[model samples]
Target: MIRNKKEYKQYLKRDRLALEIYNDGIINKLKNLFFPNPIWTFQKRMRKLEYYTNCKNYGLYKLYIYYLKYRYRKISIKLNFSIPINVFGPGLSIVHYGTIVINFTSRVGANCRMHACVNIGASGGEVQGPQLGDNVYIAPGAKIYGNISIPNNTAIGANAVVNKSFSEENTIIAGIPAKVIGKVDIKKIIKYV
Candidate 1:
């Protein structure tokens, strides 16, 4: 949880990176306020409020958190993402927001992009669910489950159901119980961080 102003700043940095926007400095951060993505904005606000509520004991912050929760809940309902804030790493981008759901126990790495109607969850036997890697992209209507480990810089095609893990990286996976259908150009999709 974010503890204070410093942690809040760090959280904002992560949020900006997750959104794939320029956040090199305060100027860029301020400029982003004018041109915000609705879905990301909703998620960002919710996460900040959640951190504040947990990190502080002051009455004012608690009240503020309560107010933000009310507003964030409305947007979350409209967007249809029932995600837990702590599950995702920095650079979690929700490209489209309709019907996206993630299990609370699942772990998503940095710079992961998810399209609409994607589900990453558990499949009965495993309570831990899927563990996704950094810079992964999940297309719309994709269902990823079980105790699987998806490698870095991979793309899961639309409507694909992934039940097992892939050991390799930079691959494009598709179909029912997804397999490596193609290869992704790693240089084109990611920057060395």
Candidate 2:
């Protein structure tokens, strides 16, 4: 959801911080160019694609956008990810490269750190998906579906099946049908938010 150059830059900075890559020097750039992390490369291309897609006067850069799309798709397939563009806000940290499927209609807030084997989608044929709030941490093997809304600073435990909406924030939800298990300090989980 990058609307302008400033917001795009801000998103990139937050993304880098979320990925824990602080340095942006020439040496670092050259190193990344030669030996890039697959996830980082994919995220970088994803951000570029999002920015250009939201830009208005990019007549000369359509080919570049297509190229970015191709690369994004290729890497996503390789990494076993089914995420769509603009679904995640700034500061998105994919902790591991594994099977992570998210519905295109789902909206995740900023500072979300998700692990592997996470599925966020609709229950059946529904088009709408879960809307997660900011500073949420989704653990590994979490299955969140339906048209639910998760509050801010919430933590979903591993292997939890969330189908209903929780009314509170800053809580941990984990169970077969996902209930508030305990309170959570989001700052301890997500460091870069």
Candidate 3:
């Protein structure tokens, strides 16, 4: 979550790096203007919403906050994402624009790279959702729920169902009920982080 201008700019820089958008020159700006990336636009709007929400809610700022919220919601719906504000830390990489649902209660650490069709929510009517550590990689179609804590530098395989916590770090978890399959160097997986 962006509380101030510094944090907001840092988050935007990290997000851009995670999305592999290096250059911000005139040519790049023209390209983006001509062919807009919905994912990038959505992330920008989400960051702005977070920043403004943390600010003093009065006068024109309040109205602008409402407008940002509306635009964020619209973009989220168009991209099939149900992510809430402040759920993810800096350097969040959404690999693809697909059905990605994250519970509002869930908290993900910095540099989380997630693929399409990923669901991170609470199970059994619980208010708490999964808390993932930094540099975590969630593959496509992975379902992670409940009050679970996934350690740092962990990678979840595709279509894996994770309901329990894993204590070990730098490992890959896969299959139904999700078990540690092999060790992984998270630096290799998440390049920008």
Candidate 4:
């Protein structure tokens, strides 16, 4: 998160790429997507900008965030991520960007990888959004919501609707109102990352 000057500078670099993607034509974006660079990708920059916005300390950060808000709106027309900045930790990896809507109230841990069409929203007023732990991998079209506490190293399968919490760490949760399906090797999933 932008705790100091160095991190803030990094955030700016990422934001600059994001702006380039937005202002530049579709061909450039497609080229970057095909020949992907970790620093130049949309997901990386978005997450980095989100990290900066979460830190409410510096005026410069706030001003940059304000500029990002405008670009974010433009970008959201093609790729939607309405998640609040403070909700997610660092190392948030988005596999693909299309119709992904994460509620602002949701809290996701570090190094979480999410695919396309994933929704993490509120179930009710009393219950807030889901709280996901570290090294969580959410597959495509997963709809996870409510006051669920997903433990570390958990994997939510594709098209799964996780309404209930799975407390077991290093487990795979799938199906509607999701339950523990099986165990997973957390180390294997995170080793390359």
Please give the RMSD to the true structure for each candidate, in Å.
3.5, 1.8, 1.2, 5.9
Q: CA lDDT of each candidate?
A: 0.79, 0.91, 0.93, 0.71
Choose 1 or 4, whichever is better by lDDT: 1
TM-score: the better of candidates 3 and 4: 3
lDDT of candidate 3 at residue 150, scale 0 to 100: 97
lDDT of 3 at 72: 98
Runs of candidate 2 with Cα error greater than 4 angstroms are 24-34
Q: Candidate 1: TM-score? A: 0.79
Q: Write the per-residue lDDT of candidate 1 for residues 86-151, one digit (tens) a residue.
A: 677666667777998889889988777778998899998778889998888888899999999999
Worst-scoring 10-residue span by lDDT in model 2? 56-65
Each prediction's TM-score versus the true structure: 0.79, 0.93, 0.96, 0.74
lDDT for each residue of candidate 2 in 59-104, tens digit (9 for 90 to 100)? 8788888888899999999999999999999999999999999999
Error of 3 at 95 (Å): 1.0
- In candidate 3, how many Å is residue 116 off? 0.6
Model 4: per-residue Cα lDDT over 12-45, one tens digit each: 5444432344436887778766866532344454
> Mind sharing the TM-score for model 4?
0.74
The candidate maximizing lDDT is 3
lDDT of 1: 0.79
Question: Candidate 2, residue 151: CA error in Å?
Answer: 0.4
lDDT of 3: 0.93
